[model samples]
Target chain A: MWRCLLLLCFATSAAAGKPDPQRQRELRSLLKNDCGACHGLTRKGGLGPPLLPEALAGKSDAELLRTIQEGRPGTAMPPWKPFVDADETLWLIEELLRKQPVSMEHGG
Target chain B: MIEINKSIDKSVPLLLLLLYLLGNVCLAELRGSGDLGVVIERERGSVLIIETSKRSILARVEKLGDLSHASVVFSRDQRYAYVFGRDGGLSKIDLLQDKLVRRVVQAGNSIGGAISQDGRFIAVANYQPGGVKIFTSDTLELVADIPAVYGDDKRSRVVGLVDAPGRQFVYSLFDAGEIWLLDMRDPSRIEIQKFSDIGRQPYDALLTPDGRYYLAGLFGESGLALLDLWHPEEGVKRILPEYGKDDEKLPVYKMPHMEGWSVTGNLAFVPAVGLHQVLVIDMLQWRLVKSIPVAGQPVFVMARPDGRQIWVNFAFPDNQQVQVIDVEDLSVSRTLQPGKGVLHMEFTPRGEEVWISVRDDNQILVYDTRSFQEMARLPAVSPSGIFFTSRAAKTGL
Candidate 1:
């Protein structure tokens, strides 16, 4: 069920491709600075659950997307729907799924 | 040729002794570390050793790993700071020399740590493996490990690890809704007093100024779990349990920090969970006296050293602004816009000045606590958590 939906979303997103470069940078910043506040900088988990590739290995795209949009109730995680749209949240999930989350960490 | 070589070797030792003594005399500058502090450069995995009096960054000590959620507690001597990193890296920095004295990766992931009353043992609260590990303050060697085992094969992440008087460590178990008191008077013999069913999801906590009460802010509910260290036998009491229960709760973007100088005199100011107000509690009765509205969700609602002013920094969407509350009338005295991403605020030892960390601007702004004027500005790289050496003398910093 989730597997089939994951395939469809991945196929569609692969064609749609990643967000623009500027939005990509903004999303990455939000991931490290905002999301990283609870989730560890390395995405190993702190106040929130870990977002490492290994942690989210089996989850489907829809489940992950809903969690980002609506957030998990009874936890510190908040819904980012006001700040980000569905498309941007999907790109963030991909960014976390990509190789080396810390590599994208930009410093001043 | 052999006799000449032997003579040169003997002379080398004598020459090195002279250079060693001379190097110590010239390089060792006699300066007190009482006014010094450190600002965490989160993105760069580094920290800046800052001097409060001059408002200058003395040195940038780099290569500290995973400082995304880093916290620091000073040694009793104020010469060293034990920084607990998100990656579970415990770094001891030498303030005088402005360098990383030693770095040790003790756990998989940790939030913060505390030093024992004697300053001999450093206890770290771990999140990943879920436990508390105590180490020798001087050598950073493992002395004791107590896992937060709440249920069958279930480990809870430890938060609010604070050292109280009588050489005891009080901390909260986040997942289990429990608080444990670890007695470390004798490092060999371990004793723990567990307070079960205290509250739900204690995100963070702080020990009071007099080191009497340990308050744990509840994220699962709208109350704070208070444990009086002087009378632990009485059990934990829930204070302000129903605050904002009927009110609308906005989605909390960032967790409110329960640790800091949030208490002063007869009153304590706490950030309401997911509400734009600061809950004022009377320390005498442990009751809610007033609820002062604020600009946004408060993160660090800290009081000045003199107890005259309360400075607050907000979380997420309104993170750019900081509001000051005049303690006399209990009102928002002034609001200052210190650029974007105002991460943290720290008062100097004397309360004459306060340092604010603006992350997006990459600048630390110092303001006069009395006049509310920007005194000085210094450059930093995405700074957070400005901790001063004065905390070394206080309990539960």
Candidate 2:
């Protein structure tokens, strides 16, 4: 049931529609916990980078999608398409771009 | 009489030219091998082909979904080229016809292959499935499948495959630190011998020329383990270290499982991927002999057939080139800048040219052996392993 909802949220994000706000928050929490370990919050710069407004501000949607899906050239970032679905990637990018910075010490 | 003498002189020059033409014809025999090096781009869903000799686009076979790796084996006559895509796409290219003759879909994404001693069969290690699939070299037909007895469906990966002298072939499964010995004397039936538990991630394995023992590099252990093929039960474990294990003079150095061994079987050259040195191990003594300092992350070390020099690919972030190491003196000889993101590379059949598969720009860069100069650049993109065929050397690929 949770997997289906996650899939639905991803589908809506990819189709360029407003996803469920409650589900979006849940998805945001997941990305913050899982992806932030390496890529960091907002994709700025950590072991990877902050995936947020300032870093991804002027980039094209295609560029963001390609980098996220196919992987950036000459880095450890592998092709995420096989691991993460397209719609979920869209939601993850959205979450990355919009999330506010949290304290680095304890918790978000 | 004067007119007759002038005519005779004119006929003399003509007769000499005729003789030269006849000699040329006799010397130009039809039976000669011409190896046409082919560069294949290993990308998702599509693979591009480029003929390196003339810098021309050959073919772009598409719809092979998410092709991660490929191995090409040319027929002895060089008439046909067999391409095995890791995503399970097997294609047969007729060099003379210049088109894909047949394709068999449904092999999984794979990393390495072991061609038969007689070059009749190729056993491919499928990464996702954690198994090795065997196919007939001539027909591209599925012959056998051997699944990983120890690998997990979600986490495990297979990297390298080496054919043992007998009916058995050794496979190194990734992350598991286990080498599985598989027997393929009969394609319809297969036997499995699980041995060599060295450490995590055995990168590549190869048999010595004498075919007595097998040497595999352990990624997690930062060493190469020499195992006796004759006694799998005994399991001989010998580690070749980057620095001398007990030497107090040199600081302890541990390479991150990306080293390569030379073809001579006497030395194992470990390219310290994160360090600034190439570790040399004398295989006979099974000890670390010397550490030659290098510039960047030397990921791959490929030895030439002559066994005099070792070609090391220093794949730093965006810094694309390969380094040549003189094995005799253990020194850095020269470095050849191949081009952007040289993900994988393979040498030509005669070792005359080195073909580099640069994934970023999606092209294979060629270099001349004798001059050590960029001979030409053929546009073949996103390629992992380069392949070649000699079938129509008269009309290059």
Candidate 3:
């Protein structure tokens, strides 16, 4: 019975595009700090291409996910697979698609 | 008849007083002098002129090319500002006239630049073609171009370009892992000194306030390479050996900026990349004495000009906060949440006030250093770096 429950938990998390609140928060920080370095803090373009919703409107979710995992060749953008997993990459794409601002907290 | 003449005399004086006040307002607008500074509008490719005394915005000049990573160095007279844009455009603007005097695209892509000690030449470090270009400060004309060649490749991104004493410029090459000194006292005959294999990847470097030592941060390794600029023949040596060697390396969200690293008295505060700590170094021994852990990954570890306290800001999840470290104890005295996206900070010349740029909030907040109380708030458009003309008189600014 314990094994069955454990399998069910794993299956649920393995589902594609499943939303996890804890993972979402971590991904938001990554997008705001890591990606935001080149892509402006406000998601406007900087040294790299802009990641705004309007800019990503034409690109599909699969395309965006692939780029995040594999990165663009011959550019400053490096593959983020080492840091973020596949599911988290999708979550980041959806966050970018929705144009959600990273909710920041006060000082620790 | 006597009453009508008295009324006319009073009305004439009132009209003259109004005219005099209007003239004074126009004159102040035209003069454009006083304690002045600039805020780099990163995405908009513009700079906003600010009156430091009034804590107000004077004007915004646009059309500075790809300013995603722009920096400015003022002329000796402090009347002109030389802006180095990321797209390799160097523009000289007259602050009094509020106009661009001259602009030239000198390279394919550039990072930051510095003005010579004599203020006669401006040197820009290029990333695309991988070299350093020197231009006449007055004309923006190319005086020398030295390619950062390593092995067989003729291109290596040059970073950490700073002007030193004796009409010389020193910089580090990222791809080549080298530090070079270029002497341009005689533009007709330039002298170059190359110190190769300084480290793995020197992302940024800074010179001491007294112009004695030049320290380069190695991104590809655990330690930093230091060069004694006063005695160039001694060569480069690694300091703080084995730093971060015992810990698992975390993904670096953004590179720690050595330009903002501060040295006060006998200690230097260095922001360690991928770590939530600021390494306090004993300058005399050139060794890491302690690591003060903070909120998150540290970006800029700037010291107050008075050398009493150090201010620190972080990256990503912790970027909204700023911390004050008391220099005497090497401990955090206070933590401040200035605003969202706290990008950069600059202090007044005398360390009376600190101006912080909140990019997401689009506001520049000035606080009294002693009380940490908000003194003024000026609207800005995604401001990043705040600079003052007072930096013009200081070395290694």
Q: iRMS of every model, one decimal?
A: 2.6, 15.7, 9.1
Report the candidate with higher lDDT, 1 versus 3: 1
Instruction: State the weakest 10-residue window (summed lDDT) of model 1 chain B.
Output: B240-249
Q: Which candidate, 1 or 3, would have the higher TM-score against the true structure?
A: 1
For A7-47, candidate 1 gives per-residue lDDT tens digits of 46654775376679998887887888788888876777788
- Docking class of predicted structure 3: incorrect
Docking class of 2: incorrect
Local accuracy of candidate 2 as per-residue lDDT tens digits, B1-397: 9999999999998999999999998986543224454455443444455554565565665544334435665665766666666445667776554567787764445554656655677677665566777878777677886677563454355665766666567767666777777777775677777764676667666565555567776545556666777788777475754433343221111112231235455776766434566777776777777888775656566666556777776543424777788888889899776666565656665567777776556666777766787766665544666655532221101
Count of clashing residue pairs in every prediction: 0, 21, 0
Per-prediction CA RMSD (Å): 5.0, 12.9, 7.4
Judging by DockQ against the true structure, name the best candidate.
1
Model 1 misplaced stretches (Cα beyond 4 Å): A1-19, A102-108, B1-28
Expressed as tens digits, the lDDT of each residue in B1-397 for candidate 1 is 9999999999999999999999999887889999999999987889999998777889999889888879999998899998998889999999998889898999999989999889999999999799999999999999998999987879999998898999999999999999999998789998999999998999889899899999999999879999999999999999988788898789998998988888889898999989999988999999998888899999999999999999999999899999999888888989999999999999999799999999989999999988888999999988888999999888888
- Point out where model 3 deviates above 4 Å: A1-108, B1-34
Per-prediction TM-score to the true structure, in the order listed? 0.92, 0.64, 0.80
Per-residue lDDT value at B177 in model 3? 92
TM-score leaderboard ranking: 1, 3, 2
